[model samples]
Target: MKKPVIFLSLLASLIASQSCTNLEEQVLDESFSPSISYADIANGTLAPVYALLPSVFLHTNYFAIQEISTDEAILPYRGGTDWGDNGIYLALHQHTQTSTDPNLKNTWNFILQGISRSVSAINEFQGKTDATSQLYLAESRGMRAYYSMLTLDLFGVVFVKNSVGETSKVIRGAEAVEYIKSELLAVEPNLSTTVGPGRLNKAAAWGLLARLYLNAAVYRNVTAQTVTFSNDDLDKVIEYTDKIINSNQYQLSPDYFSIFNSDNHSNKEIVFAVDQRAELNGHNRLAYFSLSGDQFPLPAFPAANGTDGPAITSDFYRTWVNAYGSQDPSVDPRFYKQNLSIYSNPADSCVTAESFNINRGILRGQQYGLIRKNGVFLKCPDGKMKVGKLYNDTRNRPTTPVIFTEKVDFTVAGSDYSTGYRVEKYEFSKKSSSGRNLGDADIVILRLADVYLMRAEAKLRKSNDAASALADVNTVRASRKAATPPPALTSISLDLLYRERGFEFYWEMLRRTDMIRFGKYEDTWTEKTNTDRNKRIFPIPQTAIDGASNLPGYLVQNPSY
Candidate 1:
């Protein structure tokens, strides 16, 4: 996070300065401050573009569209209140989301705001004649391309902005893809390979290019019965992935969990990430989104709370059941989770406090963590550490303390608190000077592991190179030191590739696109059955359409809205 500390400090100073002056007078007019140069503003202008990432990446917004909508995750209303939120969660999973949905509208506007900021940064950088100005210009253009890619991915159309405050013309399908490709390629040489995690660079741009081509067929023709992956696109995936893999700039992290730790800014695994800091308003959704309220870690921390939202689907979890039956992640080396225990038995742990330390994968069976009892932690029977019932905290109504269990049937009925296995992929940020909920962890957007997986998939899809694909997949598996390592598969198939992606990149914002490309998004799974083929892309947010009223026909809604 400190690699670009100068730019970060400048941006912070500008934000702090805005608080001292009247809001109305801070406009980009001739009345601009005589003390500060426009170059100074241009240098820090990318801050707004960076600011929009957290909102887009948060679990309830863009993440909701990417993951929750697929079979990987779901957030059901506990006791008809905790997460009902007008049935947006249910609608997303069920593929019945309307354009007016708050999440959809908010996410759409947030990405547009990023586009707006990118345009502003470019204009400001234009006025400055310096080496630093060119760097800023390239980074700004890269950011614009990234945001535009997201807009095009989620909603088929992207707004075309020639300059600031101009009416953006909506470009969809093939046209949008071409624009994004051209923009990324244009900025690639100018982008600094130095200073990353917080800023986009050459490697990140290459990763983005790889992603675009990998999904180009789907982006160009979503309505095709089976989207065709051309050899050129597949080669591009391999070409760009090799650039990162052979560049020697990045490598897979030794500790898989450390890649998501609060101190992950230095992790080599990350190609591009949101440098969320404890000092700033960072997101903690990945840390506690699925955790029960009573299962607090380091409860001594003040005012700590977990929303108890999303949990992985049973079908997703069942992917682990291989030819050898249910794989115990303990020995599975790389592709496994720590074993979860239910009680504070001396047999499991000589000291009860030791039982609370659970594994870092799909959490199932009885859960154990710090439990409050009469202002102190209560120990279990003959057990050393504290234990108590996990109350269903919907409406703050403490329902009967129930032991956590796997309810194979997900989409729990109203008030049926126990169901799907909770996901704990991101290392929880318990120890931080700044707020834990606003965590310190840098959320990784692209990584080396993903690069490897993408290569494997591209190889499989393009040339039926099963042996090479299997080797790539196994390389990732071998990297992790699981207590019980699942043996690497001897053969590879499209189905295995799809499951491997779920195993490697489940909670990350890539599931929905993966499901569609794999031809599984339309299949029935758990609570989701009404999957109309056309629902692959969400309806363009109604707010986006209304906001573009000034442009008339330019912002036509995508197909069915």
Candidate 2:
């Protein structure tokens, strides 16, 4: 799938000179250069789109802010004595500015770049007789549609452009959805059925379409938007899910932890994932975002990695416990595998309830002593425990282990254990440090489990198909070895669906969209309260506003702006 050298050069020029005085001007100038062939331009376009995925980890991006906006998670750090207020975007998101913030702008930029690349690829395949080029062009369309979904969700409007040089045509609401549908339908002929996950395939395009239609009512108030589901949308969702589930290209992983394990990449459970290669591609800070210092296992963890952990709020953890706990909390396995808690123990010998205790040793005593879910807690050369700045008792010092009931937060100033749960998704080896560790874990962007859950949601909404919906939901539950799946899916309310989504897709980047779709976008929480309605889309960036003049209403700020 390697492309021509000219395309590579075009990509290099755009990415390498990203910091130039005027980005739009620089890109526009590069687009007009006749030396670059259409084929070269199309081939080079993908480099930046792939490059953009990694930029989510960039400081100015929405990775952190979007999470804060959703109820699935929240940061404990508020305007406090030692905490950094910059993470305030989380609070601001919950409260104000939906149309244009720096985060919103970055998101807009990210998806547009993705769309641009896809369009470029589409143009490159125009004259090529090669089947591979057509396949790639189709994949590019799917990618654009996927990104356009995000853009519409976050910004309420996004520009639709066909070629690299064309000015964007701003489309909003139904128009945007139609545009996305058109792209997917048009490219279906060329898209391959077998391209594995992380790469968009024909089925994946349908999945996105299903998702878009499922959430249509929320985006635009069609009649019965909340209570009524369109039969057409429901059918599309089912059709798409059927194609993927029956395709045999993917399936649910038997072990919950196996999905997150480094060795289990490319497994059947994963339909697609952002392939993060340490040192080569780009590493997702997911490792750094969800980790807590107190419970972190490695002595060299912080030195080797950035420890800006996002802890689980006590509320969300309680929800998981209430939903799955069978009298004993650890019975679920997912709670233990996906999160770090006081009860987590590293010793493989300790299996059942009685053998496991949160208050065991210096490494298991203090707040930071809690065991991580998947990886073993490592010991120092002196046999003492390792502690981060959050749990480092000044009086006790790092060398000495505080082996008692001293309460200290095991998180950084930028984050707090406001929710009281931190994610343990990626399990790095005891010997590994930083995201560079061969923790070659595949980040599941789409999986069979999610498809099942989504089908249940769509079915329940479409025709009160509670029995069928329950079966679909329970299929996943049964897969998890739940002694008894929810009997008959009696409570198929939106709230229940949300809880199901929370439990099923926790820590994935879908939370913000889920919240928005469920009419919970404007709601308030522990550290987040609605600032205004326009804040829902994020403010159009000041920079963008400054750059375009004739685009008067074209760049009109979202509501409350």
Candidate 3:
């Protein structure tokens, strides 16, 4: 799954460079020369789309909007002043985002940026003559379809652009879903079989189809109702998932922690990902966002401070409690309760120097890592590591020991650091003084374990079939576990499947989709008590509607905006 050398060269070329995301794409046809071959230009067509992935899938982008809106994660303003971006996180958790919420606008703009880039790529490689060129064109369409699917899923609308700078048809509901599905299937045959990570390939297309099929009913329903899963839809889910599983193109990671490591480009389980390298322009916010200021993962490196806030809700943490009943997180492969070790390396250039086994999954209890004393990490007298205590960084108790907790009140007045259990799914950058604010590891857009979980859900929904679903669930559980094996269940249900997904894919940007599909989104959780059904899909950004010169009346806001 290493990055292609041509793709690396594509990143360095001026042809791949992009103007502002909000701006129009300029035609670069005349700039190509005899020295820069046609293949390079064709590959260069894909660079903008690849570059836009990080903006859409990063921790603070779609990942936060999707996960924080549900119970999987939250980023409350620390001590009331720090993260209080006009109460975006609180409003998100409460399902109260308006058309003016900056978070929604940011997410919308970034996804549109991706769509615009994909369109530009499609227009640039329209008359390619080589297999490589055709593959680039196919990848462009596939990437376009992928971005459109996200747009449809989140906003319930898709902008149909036949070519660059063309007026888009405002497609909504089932029409949009069909458009995205058709686009993906059309390019499925042309995608490269050997496309590496960060690039969309046939396997990724299959997974996307399965996801679309899984949610086809919801997309069609528009209005909230009990979703009836058709046998055909279930078959498509099972079929597409099996295609990825049987192709042997990818497999579940033996160590779940390795999947999120800073140097995880080699993991075979990653079907498609955002190629994020510190030197190649990546951010470390995924790891740095949740970590407390005192709990430094890399003692020698102080690149960017970890702004602690993203943590699991009590309801989300209670899922494990209901399943394991105080069982140690080590017992479950998906849950890494403690972040104990680091991967230390000083000699490697263009990579973070500090490295250790920083744990993955949900974190609870007293936080322990390198403690910053004065300017350096403080050690212990008994030779054991010193556990760090977080403080209410925005309030009167900046130095007090603010222990982490699972119970959180979204409407409470004071900001307590001990509101919820923190998550460390992404590896932190080990650079002591790296200038870049981005993480070194590529953010995983889709992985094999999640696909397996989808197959399991499809089986359960098809006919309450448990045995087949159990095998798939246990398959992932076993692959991610230590020496001790997870107990195989003799039965499976929707509740079990939901909890299993929570264990498997927490904070990877699937929680909102899972919660909706399982019919648990409307139920009260943590600080969210909104029962309005319209809150399921976000309102189309008002800015977008105002900016839509072509589709003025067509770009209507979603209901109850």
If scored against the real structure, what TM-score would every candidate get?
Answer: 0.87, 0.77, 0.88
Q: Alpha-carbon error at 375 in model 3, in Å?
A: 3.3
List runs of model 1 lying over 4 Å from the truth: 1-42, 127-129, 323-326, 333-359, 374-402, 408-415, 431-436, 482-485
- Candidate 3 error regions (>4 Å): 1-30, 337-357, 379-399, 411-414, 431-436, 481-483, 549-551
**Relative to the unseen true structure, what is the C-alpha lDDT of residue 512 in candidate 2, on a scale of 0 to 100?**
74
* Superposition TM-score, candidate 2 onto the true structure: 0.77
Find the 10 residues in a row with the least total lDDT in model 1: 16-25
After TM-score superposition, what is the CA distance of residue 334 in candidate 1 from its true location, in Å? Answer: 5.8
| Model 1 lDDT per residue over 317-395, tens place | 6666553474464344334355334343424432344334435766666655555544455565785765344554432
Q: TM-score: which candidate is best?
A: 3
Comparing 1 with 2 on lDDT, the higher-scoring candidate is: 1
Model 3 poorest 10 in a row by lDDT: 6-15
**Candidate of highest lDDT:** 3
Q: Rate the local accuracy (lDDT) of all candidates.
A: 0.72, 0.56, 0.73
